[model samples]
Target chain A: MTSYTDKIREISKRLLKEGKVDMVIGFTRGSVPMMHQPMFAKNQGDVDRFVWDGNCGINLANYVTDRKEKIGIVAKGCDARNLAVHIVENKINRDQLYIIGVPCTGMLDRHKLTASVAGEIESIMEDEAGKTVTISGNGFSETYDRAAVLQENCSLCMHRNPVIYDELIADKVPEQSENDVDRFAAVRKVEEMTPDEKWAYFDDLLSDCIRCYACRNACPLCYCPTCFVDESKPQWVGKSIDPTDIRIFHFLRAYHCAGRCTDCGACVRSCPMGINVRAMTKKLEKDCLENFGWEAGLTTEQRPPLDTYKPDDPEQFIK
Target chain B: MKNLLEHMGIDPGRLHFSWISSAESTKFVEVAKKVTEEAVALKSKEKKYMKTKPKVA
Candidate 1:
């Protein structure tokens, strides 16, 4: 990962020096352990601050929306897919970007790592071989296999290499084959439950929601000028933390991203209450894939299934 | 919309979608009857998403 960081800095510096892009977006070490913050490098001097590691879970595609200046963004597989989405949506132009693709090796889940130990994490170090992560706190220190603590989305990722890139930092890594991972196993578990059981399951899942909207803010797809939740004429969702309100908020938000979500795990990563917000979105993703033979952000040339009319489109639900 | 609602444990019959032109009264009536029958069948199930009166102040 250090070599990845070095290569990123080298490329970003050259881009900045040559005046190819007005800004370069990448990740920098966060103030705390296992939280990487997005950094915008506008000049050659700022290039040295960029770093890459397992902690860069936040999607860089969120930062490039509607930007007027040319951008050189550091994109992993999911981020690059999102960039493709942005291009298709006309939020940004393809000519305005210089995508620095980083073939991902999955991001570490901080919650999983924290749950493994009893104390607060003071520092974390990833081995040069990129196979192990060591964390130390007050009195305890432990090393964990990188694969064991990977975020759920990362483990199930089918596209680990960027779909689009101007230049890649390293040779593409192997992708997770469909046979190796049952991507819809969680969705299937929920599907088997009775209606009452399913309701109770989601009720328990969203019991801790604080209505902070961290998930909304973190998502790259949520760029609406006046989100439905904020509408006054006929407010689609209540602002209070009522269980019904929370459920509606989550449901509608998931609906909005029906055919466009890349399952980048930004919503899951940003939740302060540690909600598995992917539960709602992943169901839609599975539906899109199964019903329409569509996966979001795979290409910019074609519109999503939901956005276009097709003669063979599934209409089973419409009686 | 119906798929997601059903996925969240809502009764699939509660929502219905049909393409009926204004002149097609027979088709509209036929679809409406089916929808109402399905909704009535599940009437005994407790409503899942309806906002109720505050149980406690």
Candidate 2:
């Protein structure tokens, strides 16, 4: 609920002005202040434009891959997780990053909230303590529990605190409980299905796929500049949109994201088809938690479960 | 019954079929198309449908 813009900007500007950081990365108010987008700041002027709120959706950590030099960045809880993975993979230099940790209580479900209102957000203001939301229309204002309209994933967030950070501005956030992880019930329904029924479900889901890799692109873990699917050298999933290849692409994505994913739910949000894609990751995430006791993007020291092998490791995949 | 993929100009010889056979009447072909396209795309150029030579019976 803390809009740490002034603090972040102040720090970022100081860093930039003093040459401690080459640039600062944070959220900027979008076309309408209701929505927000990322901004790469070089100086105080650019830093002044940075803001943070629920509407800041995209995982800006994806931008840090393959970059050099010192950079200060504003990180949400999810962004912090993604950054941790990057650090573990040696894809990012942690020493170079001045992470300004921002605690997100949760985000507003804009789609549902907009419909609840008069289809327009007249104004949004910080609550007295700066820890709640107050939506106003012309002059009529309503203050409610901030947790009510959070995004599905945010509501069920397990990693709300920045796993990696140089500075934490506000109070330490709370840990996520098992109940915070959703999509288990939906996954269970599928698990109870017969083989044919499962195939039918996948068939229905994949058929709706237009071969667009929005799910891949939205994923912060999917940072490979040139992905295998895009490999013309040995074309993995072609542009043909053939059912099998499309199906494999989906599987490939799921498997690739398996232990590497932070369960940020970007893949679901960005999907044009709205195939309940989060359901898959959520299912996989639950399995990872229940079976392996591993959560992705939580730490740089802990290897992604799939990548690291131990002779003593439980072989659940054993026949 | 005419195959759902028949109108899609797919090569049956080069194709792979995944049937989501169910007890009830919910056979959706639109979903079938997605799997079909993916199988076709994922089938590498080096890997051909190995047609078995018939034994002289």
Candidate 3:
């Protein structure tokens, strides 16, 4: 596989040279050493500043969606899918975009991966042998086995291939999860538990929460200009660390995001509280898939499953 | 998610990770320290594992 640096340079050069786009929103090495964040390039000098690899991990769709100009983006599989969702949401004008699709195996969890080779990480790049990550530290340079060093999500990604893009970089990768797992099956199992047991588990879990709203901010579907949590007219959820308020906060956010959520797993990853709230989202995704035969954002013709309702729809479990 | 983080090198006993509706930080700092220690320990293990490879079979 070609390194993203080369691919991004080629795409940027072409976009500028052909006058096909106005700007390139990609990623480069972060201002902080060893970190990676989104980088925007408009001029040729900045094109050389672009870099792509597992390290270009942040979903850049949000940046592009928030803007109103003609822009080409460096999108990996997930980022591209998110862009598709944004397109359907009407948050972005699809015609204005020139998507440079890059197939992604997955992204490394930077904190975990960097610390794994702390004081190393001389240069990060990929090649035919897989990720050619060369790390030099403490008077030694060691090469890590690419696949093993890849992020956890990359190993089990169902959509390594970009769903939509103007260009293709590699042969599309296949979906990873196929089993029709009853998403509500776990919730049902919990329902069977005594109320005491249910709360016991919940209490055990939420006790570590240090209320940082990373989940809300990370979500692409949660595009409310003003969230209910911040509204003081009703004081929707308590300001302090009240446990019930926390519960209500998460439940409301997830419900608001229901049907809209793409199950990108971004919310869970962004949570400093470490709540893996994706469990709720996965359940919602399964419901959308099984009942309405819908997967969010894959098609422009379909309405969000929760947004539409039928008289005969199953409400047996509804209180 | 707990299981997944464990793979990333978090030990629940020390670095308690859970949903917000569940926290009881009565001993917040003590608990935080324990969690930090565990995370650091796991990171160090990854450092060792990643740095040196065993003899190939």
**Models sorted by DockQ, best on top:** 1, 2, 3
User: How would the candidate models be sorted by TM-score, starting from the highest?
Assistant: 1, 2, 3
**lDDT (10s digit) by residue, model 1, range B1-57:** 777888887876678988899999999999999988998998887566666536443
TM value for model 3: 0.71
Best by DockQ: 1
Task: List, residue by residue over A1-319, the lDDT tens digit for candidate 1.
Answer: 8899999999999999999999999999899988999999999999999999999999999999999999999999999999999999999999999999999999999888888999999998999998999999999999999999999999999999999999999999999988999999999999999888988889999989999899999999999888888897896777777788889999999999999999999999999888999999999999999889999999999998888999999897676
Worst 10 residues of 2 chain A by lDDT: A310-319
For TM-score, candidate 1 versus 2, the one ahead is 1
Model 3 ranges off by over 4 Å:
A32-34, A111-128, A131-152, A177-198, A273-275, B1-57
TM-score of chain B of each: 0.75, 0.33, 0.38
Ranking by lDDT: 1, 2, 3
Off by over 4 Å in 2: A1-3, A32-34, A110-145, A179-183, A203-208, A316-319, B1-57
Q: Pick the winner on TM-score between candidates 1 and 3.
A: 1
The alpha-carbon lDDT assigned to residue A117 of candidate 3 equals 62
Give the CAPRI class of candidate 2: incorrect
Which of the predicted structures, 1 or 2, would earn the higher DockQ when compared with the native?
Answer: 1
Model 3 preserves the real interface contacts to a fraction of 0.00
Best-performing candidate as measured by lDDT: 1
